[model samples]
Target: MRLPIVAGWPACTVMNCEADQAGYGEDKCVTHLSEGELGGWLSRLGPEAEIHLARTQLAKGTLDQIKGAVTGQDDVPQFGYLSLRRAEIEGGVDLCYSRFSKEVDLYGLKVSKYLDFEGVQVSGGLDANFIEAPQGVDFYRAKIGGSLNLEGSKVGEQVRVARCDIDGSFLLRGCQVSGNVECYEVKVSGPAYLSNMQVVGDISFRNSSFSDGVQFFYTETSGYFNVSDSEFSGFVEFEGLRIAHDLIWERASFRDDVTFDKADLSGLVQGSCLFYKGVNFIRTIFRSAVIIQACARRVDFWGARFEVGGTLLLRYAMVRMTGAILAGPTSLVAFNRNFVDIFGDPMDEFVIPHEDPNVKLLDMGSVNAGNLTLVDIDLTPCRFAGAFNLDQLRLEGEWNFGTPPSGRVGITPFTWAKRKIIEEERQWRALRSHPLVLRSGWGDPPDNPRDVPGVAALMTTYRQLRKGREDAKDEPGANDFYYGEMEMRRHNQSWGKGERWLLQFYWLLSGYGIRASRAFGWLIISMILTILLMMGFGLPQDSPKQEAAGTVPPGGGKVTFEIDKEDPRNPIGDRFTSKRFERALNVTLNSVVFHSSDQDLTTTGTYIEMASRFSEPVLLGLGILAIRGRLKRGS
Candidate 1:
């Protein structure tokens, strides 16, 4: 219910144009009237001084506004406080915003503006539909309250709503714009649904506030967007959008889910698409996914619990969270099956890159979803043909290497990828935790698989492809245990046979014999400890009889006395001359009396017998080796 401007006033006599521009003023001019009827007429006549009336309400639909030409620059029309509410609008609005100085206003009404809203609303719904504003609709400094509904409107001009205040939805559904749209500082209280809208120029929502939602679902645009610092209280959607230019959403905040389901982003995307705490996607795609072209912040996609398809590309992204998951080939099974062309080199046009000026490879970082629900999506082929990027999500769910192949044809890249993912997942826990081969050095790489390198390399390669993970909603945090569970199952696995084999090969060839060295080192340390214990207790130190600390050395107890004379086997000489020797003997005797560990070797007849038996086998084996050596010499 808007206050419509008073019209149908009598016109002045010496007017430049005809009826529509300045018609009969109610007080005089018409069937039996004159401009002189009101002797107190102004010396100069303006647009509002004269007005006309339509004989009847529109039959099909009510006209929202009108558009007409001005005779001259000075001969501008002035429509003060015009209002059209709930008026049925069919064919078009003829004289809506004909001249610049008309104070136009609109309430609940439909309009087709081949006409205009030029300088109309000082601040109101300047409804202009069907008008290809080749020049653009300018609401320069207009204060408008309520929603600006442009549903099914075709705007050829840039829609400039700089510094406007509106309360309702700025519905631009199914609208097509050939120019840029600048909505700087325009505050919207409800959903600004531009769903299914197409824009050929740049679009921006810098410093704008969306109290409800901001929808650009199923829209196509070739222009770059700058929605930095924008706030969306509800879910903001660019779902199924086809973009040919860069999209800069730097510092924008999403309180709910921000979806890019099946969106084809052909250019660069800068800044964070913060996945709100609990958003989920089922089928998304990202082909040749690129993040910030320069400020390579790894967009956090760790919250992604949705299945996506497309070439994932986080070459220079900062992966967020210690719990972040870098999707592998398994994550892109959908894309491999649906969008990728096999049997040759890859296609260039298919890649969607992010090249924001402030973006660099390092920008790809770990996803932070500490206070959120985890999402681990099961990937599929049908999902990739759509526009989904693995780089655009934060998965709190256990990363999975999906379904096994059902047949030979199923053993395609997608299947193999699935296998790799599964295998990697199985070994993830070990790889991330206590790595088997921990030393960093120059060692020969293991023999690779027939199709690719070993499982680890393959998985890493797959991770490399996932470059554009992002998040749209972020609100809550997840508990440690449940959050760990949500992590890709790959991180919870143990090393597999493949991993072991590689480690084993490296150990053998490096000659560092790390495993054996570790074992022997520990063994030596144990022997030293035994000696120290024996000496500490003032007992016979060199005696293995120290409680038989270690399992009988592989060769029983027939350890031949191999000590050099200079390094005497024992201080217990058969005949001692010095009192020191006697004292030592007495002490050794006393210590032996007190120590249970210093077993009397001579009294342990069982050990002697075992030693003799062990000697027999060794002797026999040596005898054969000697005979072999002699035989070789004779030959």
Candidate 2:
């Protein structure tokens, strides 16, 4: 029913309400309408009509009895400006699908029930400062053209802004959410500030996009907080955050720097994200597990601390940074299948697979922990590109590498064949390469002197580790890593020509002091060869004429005297006839054993004897040292 319009007076079309006394317009009216009356009035306005509340306030005084301000679904009501400052909403406020043409000011308002703004389109900014919602607040799928300011608000239940698009800055500083706070799939155009927020339940920003900077400084969350799959185009700061439950940021991308300095996470902190710029986790503490699957660019964990409740896993992560500091005693499991690139140059045409495929590059140079358990890790394939500062590291438990669950697998015949084939292919390719050929491949081979950083790092780490083991009286461990250090030195292409030759010579002679038995083997082979030479040449055929002389000749000659039973020197020994082969064998044995035999040594035999005397003692000494080392290790 249309209301009558009198001269200079107009009433609400449905009700006999007088026009807004503030003289907003004939069509606008401020009434203390019931929910039914308001719903009917809004329904009558239809989609084409614009609700102009300029200079007019539609105040609901007894709204406590109403179930909802707008309950039933009608076409979205178009409002010029929404000003509900200091208004008290006893029940829920559903502004779903509502389109506000201008700014929305709900400052200092209190809602006893849920406050929903689902699918709402606000052309101007949204200001909900100091707003209190006891039930919950939702802005699901809402599109805000201007900034969304919800500073100093307190929500009893969850605050969901899932799938919302805010064209302007989103501010929720000093807000308190009693329940979960979800901002999943939200796209914010400007800076988003949620500093000092207190969320009792989980908080999520999954799949959201923050074009400008985002800050969550000093924010506290009792339950899980996730920003998984979110994209931050600008700087993201989460300094001084306190999370009681797990904090996850799996697959998130940050275009600029992200800082999480001084954060205290009581539960697991998992991140498998990408950071184009630098990232900092300085002084952060994780009470439970802290896993970082992957990250790009610099990542600084200068003073981060982790508790022992769970393992700190850094699987498949690539971090290009100066270093990461581990300051506490914890179990660190760093497994990266993709870490094979560190073993070789990424720009090389051919890359040799790492000694272990499961090797991970851990920059433990800045680690300051006393006791750390490094399990299922192999340092052989690691490329420590910088100074491995282990001066302050006090490794407590067994420094496990090539051991247990993730240890190297025994290669089967088929596996070996496959590897050989691959190696042959690489060798063939290398043979055809020109010295000036550009290295354009995925493998990182050491092509220049600058590429020796990994070798230097390995050398430093191995030396330090060996020293630590030696100090602890772990002879076996020390010896094991001693070989590792030698291997690094041997493979270092940056060594000078003389140094390389010396290393190769040492390896050939004594296997770098580890395989003394090899030297002993060579000594035996030399003795055998000498024996054959002496037998074949017959030891210069000692002159027979010299035997007749009364004086002994300088080149001693064989004395063949007639055997007479009357001769006392001959006695019965002359009855035992020996072959020439026997005589030569005896002489050779005497020469090698450094013993004087009755047979005279000829000039050629003298040379063989002198060579054996020189080499035998050296070989024996090496064997003794090897045995000593083995005994010390066993002990």
Candidate 3:
């Protein structure tokens, strides 16, 4: 409702209701200054004026009755030129500001209701503290100098100062504003504060400047965001806001990651901290993975998620999920498990803790989005394992490369490389063979023989391990240990899987072996012939023929014998002669016994000594026979 224009009203004071309305058309109002009359009322009203309205001017003096007084008027009392210049309303409610002329000073007023100083100059201080209304302030173009203090006041409506010049921040941190704070295009030289209180509606400070800390802590919201295009000199923090909707920070410049680390966000987040110091989402859960990063400053999604699914590309950007994480991608992040689950991957290039506080990265365990493309990938250092279908997954590389991504692959090198260390450990340390008996020649011919040099080595190790003087014990007792020890040792040391290969070699060697067996067989047959010759023809006792044959590593043999010629029935009994060598390759044997025979002989002694002397050739021949026997079996 427009006010009347006959309003040549004088200023209000502690006097009458129509005191300002008395100056209808008079010059006496300014001239007739009485003892109790205020200067402002006298300036606007003529001498002929009689009413006075000074009682309601936030005055402290006792009010006097006016000539023409009435109550219950809706119109505001008037203010003659600069009358509110240095007025002080320290603690009051429902004060109005629309009546004053533009650019007039109205400082230090502790107002409650609307202080509509719109487009006017508050060259003096404006104090709107302990007020009842929030939209109680409307400084459309007001100039404040002495720190316009709105320190502590319950605000119920909007506090708009759009296009207004604020040499200081419009600070309202602990003050709850139930309505929106519309300060679009306002120039503030200081930092803003709309934090620590609930704002039921959207609060916008678009295109505003705050030179210090701009913070909103523990605030609860129900709709759109409260920040955009706002410049803050110091760090801005919204650490614990309970936002019930989407919070966008597109192109917002802050030295930090638009930090929303502990904030409870409930809708789609589609912005970037491309240049932000860090946006920590350490343990914040989201409903989707649909996050947008359009040239973000930096992101630190230590533990944040988009409960829904979508891509979170850090294309041409850097990000980091700094530490202790359980977040997934709204879309998909190919940065790997350790990058997401293990947060703060120092070596990753695309992600570093800086500007962006990662608020939308999800934790989907392993990749659940189809499959990863691993073609032409550097599998050199990477070990891939899982249930995967590589048929559809595509990896980027040139087709002209040596082997195509899906070509017939030979993974021998790769396989060995992956398991080589373990296999080597199993072969060497894990499968160590501390031999109990190092020797055992099972089917080794007596004449052609088993090696004896390895005996000491076998005995030393066996004695130390077994700690028993009884015998050396090879695990399997023969094939792998020393021959002498094989017959003597007793222990079971073959307790590993690698030792199982010995079974096949064992059966194959447990037969009449070719070369050594035949040589031993030949020598044995010659011994028997010599013994028969001595017994049948009395081949002169120690027959000078047999003493010259013996051993071999290559091929040789030896024989010896004994003979007795006394009793007629003896028939050259107990005599022996044998041979089985050619030059150094030949072997021989001989023996005899007569009336002067010692206790080591009898009529059978001749034959016994003969048999003993020919024993070497006998054994060699047997070895030969054994080899032939094996060949016969093969045939």
Clash statistics: count for each candidate: 114, 5, 131
For candidate 3, what is the TM-score? 0.41
* Model 3 alpha-carbon drift over 4 Å, by segment: 1-113, 122-127, 146-148, 270-276, 285-290, 315-317, 322-329, 332-635
Candidate 1 wrong stretches, greater than 4 Å: 1-135, 271-284, 293-635
Q: What TM-score would you give candidate 2 relative to the actual structure?
A: 0.59
TM per candidate: 0.42, 0.59, 0.41
TM-score of 1: 0.42
Tens digits of per-residue lDDT for model 3, 564-635 = 334323324433333212111111243211122232223453565555455554455445544443344211
- In candidate 2, residue 372 scores what lDDT? 52
Measured by TM-score, the strongest candidate is 2
Model 3 CA lDDT for position 410: 43
Q: Where does candidate 1 have its weakest 10-residue lDDT segment?
A: 474-483
Question: After aligning candidate 3 to the native by TM-score, how far in Å is the CA of 370 from where it should be?
Answer: 11
lDDT of 1 by residue, 49-76 (tens): 3223212123322222121222235544
Query: Which of the two, 2 or 3, has more lDDT?
Result: 2
